[model samples]
Target chain A: MRTYGNSASVVVLLAWLLLPFATARAESIVLASTTSLDNSGLLGRILPAFTAKTGIEVRVVAQGTGQALATAARGDADLVLVHDPEAEAAFMAAGHGKTRVEIAWNDFLFVGPQSDRTAIGGMTDAVAALRLVSEAGAIFVSRGDNSGTDALEKRLWRAAGIVPAGQPWYRDIGGGMGAALNMAAALDGVTLTDRGTWLSFANRRGLVELVHGDARLINRYRVIELDSVRHAGAKLGPAHVLAAWLAGAEGQAAIGAFVLGGEVLFHPGVREIPPGE
Target chain B: MEEFVPIVLRSLAVSLAATGFAIAIGLPLAAALALGRWPGRPIVVVMVNALLGLPPVVVGLVLYLLLSRQGALGVLGWLFTPGAMVLAQTVLATPIVAALAHRAIEGRWRRYGPTMQAAGASRWRALPHLVRMAARGVATAVLAGFGRTVSEVGAVLVVGGNIAGFTRTMTTTITLETSKGNLDLALGIGLVLIGISVAVSATVLVLAGERR
Candidate 1:
């Protein structure tokens, strides 16, 4: 009505286009997580829900447990979801992570080919099974990648008081769980793997569960916020939110109920005794 | 990633070995095709061409089946070593090199094949000349194959197991870094890879040009 529909409207239109740019930008948090949780679809199922409810955008970068922790140390990621508690504690003590807490629990099992010459069948004891595998030189496959699974496997061997070097049948496969399992299956050998990924593997042609359900077979997962102190100055906003959300009840429940092949894959727990605790 | 530099270097060494082995296998075969005519030459050409598209994972799968502890080549026990990675890259690189070399030589062989014959040179006597002429193209093929071998993540990850301080290669390092969200390290490794590729390609081009 005031003849404002002239060329001045172009400036108004440009202002309209630019007005949204002045508002506060949503802070997107990057979470580096293990392949197990990501592959298990827990992140997929939970992230969308979290974003919808909280309006915080989340970007996930998934890999093996070791890589995730290493990434957090580099300050490239705000948070990490990983399973190797000992390593996570080391990271925390190193000041790479500000706060770390156990968010889930699972078990590691020895998988093997069905012709159980090691007689691992119906055996609930993992140490004994390992002893048999080692003594028999039964082509034991190792995830020699220094991954959490690999680290645990090495610990078990040491705990059992066995050194697995230069043994013809004791093979070191510096690979992922799937590759290690495949290596073992092809050889009909024995190897350690996380139950979640192993149970999820559809190509379990000749593989069978050998040793699980052992007290020592306990597997735990943790979420840690990257520490900027060690990093010499980095923003902790996303890291704080990510760690808080993971420790929150919703995050813990989301973890425990995550499934693989229609079976519950993880048992989340907020309370875990840290090393020397 | 800076963390995986040693790994990538080890993998680069393996790729070099694979390229060396593949060029050894491919050159003679390419030369033979350039000089000789066999009953199944057409069939051989088609086979080599088909092999150009061989998937690395498929090769990895086959090698895994063959070299796994219970498999046929298990006695070699090379399942997790840089050797296995070299073997897989060798297999993948051979066909590419052979095909490219053959294509390069065949076109020239038609023109130069009879010149030597006219000069009372037996086809066998013409071998050296043909090889000299094809050397530049063959060098390029070998360099390209090396590029492919060094940059591959799947086959090496499958065959070598991406073992830290062992069979870890540049490709696997990038993957490990990315998933770990160590973008700085990942970018560092990526830059190294690009640098290596550029330097190698330039060296090959210079060498090829000099020969021409």
Candidate 2:
């Protein structure tokens, strides 16, 4: 009986300790977002200010843009912050999102080893540089995870009129931006990466930006509020609050203010115009 | 880092809570399986034993499907929370504790069954005595369950979403930092986790020595 009492008391104590975790906070919302945004430390830098101002806790689940959209589609998240415009349009057309707004923009860079084997260094034309890399059969690491970056890479390959797939020079590692960058560093290969993640990444052994400022290389990040009518469990109020806050002046300033190593990561206040305008 | 302390504390609290739930459900099932004579007893024992090898990722995926907003149990809204992580860890640790406890209690039942039966003790009546006599092994089984829950990252990662300062455990943090190419921070967290494992093992050894 003594042992039973002691164990029962211990169980009660554990339950007491876990009670807070079992309950949901009314002002809290889940934001499904991309690894680029998270790995860049941008969200870490700005989210605390949002939370402090609104008293709303934002829990971010950082995945690829495709997975982030899919997570919101499944009603697992109240909002999504991603950079894949085509996928975001498709998700909106599918009625998974109520509202979408572009919050920031960053350009992608063609990064490769400093050896410049294909002589793509200081190249302004992304398509031509990719063609050179492809013709030279230089090792190119691909994200291949249906992320926004992967989508852009596919488009670039299409423009170059070359199928790097089934070629030994192309390494399609279905992973995040950081993973692709790490692989690129390890193999001394070339890869496309967002400025944010590339700036924050620390494992670069010999990689350097080879191509940038192409019209097709702009990466735009947007925040979408999940449709509460479709998903009853969606924290619509808090989600709307967060979405509005992100597009508003304070959030835009915060995004602009986020810097790493004396370089601004994202340009804010780029509103998305309605299509067919 | 200043954040390291909270992460360690959260990991301990979550795993400890999960181990408590595993013990609450597993010990009775273990007792019943080890001491009772029932139809399909062999199959039940075999199934429990087989479940000992259940993959954490598979368990995580299934639990994710079950707890997602589209899932049947979605109304409970447990996904991406510490609650969900605890539930996943409980599912993972339960079978381990049960199978290990079953093995230990079965051995005790084999040695004491006839004598207890001659004294008119039914299996239910003899359960407490057997458990008490096999206390050391049972404690080890509990420790094994704790170890499993503390070290596992897959299930928690799937269900908890690895939200910083919320559902992030030591293993999940290590995974996240490594993926972010912060190998030094990841190694630091890994060393902390290893230190914890070593401490738990030392405690187990001390208990064993005391029993001897």
True contacts kept of each: 0.00, 0.52
lDDT of 1 by residue, A140-202 (tens): 988887678888888888988999977898888777776776677678888898877777655
Indicate the docking level reached by candidate 1: incorrect
lDDT by residue for model 2 (B31-131), tens: 88898778998898888888888899999999999999889889898899888988999998998889999988999999998999999998889988888
What's the true lDDT of residue A124 in model 2? 86
lDDT of 1 by residue, B1-212 (tens): 23454555565577777887888998788877777788888888899889988999999988977876456886675665567888999999998888888877776678888887898888778877776787777777888788879788788876666544445677876765454334466678888888988887886777666667
Count steric clashes of candidate 2: 0
Give the per-residue lDDT of model 2 (tens digit) for A223-264. 887776887778888888888888999999999999989999
Best by DockQ: 2
Q: How many Å off is the CA of B158 in candidate 2?
A: 1.1
Q: What are the per-model DockQ values?
A: 0.02, 0.52
TM-scores for all predictions: 0.55, 0.92
The pairs that clash in candidate 1 are: A174-B161
lDDT against the true structure, per candidate, is: 0.73, 0.87
Model 2: runs farther than 4 Å from truth?
Answer: A1-26, A275-277, B118-120, B204-212
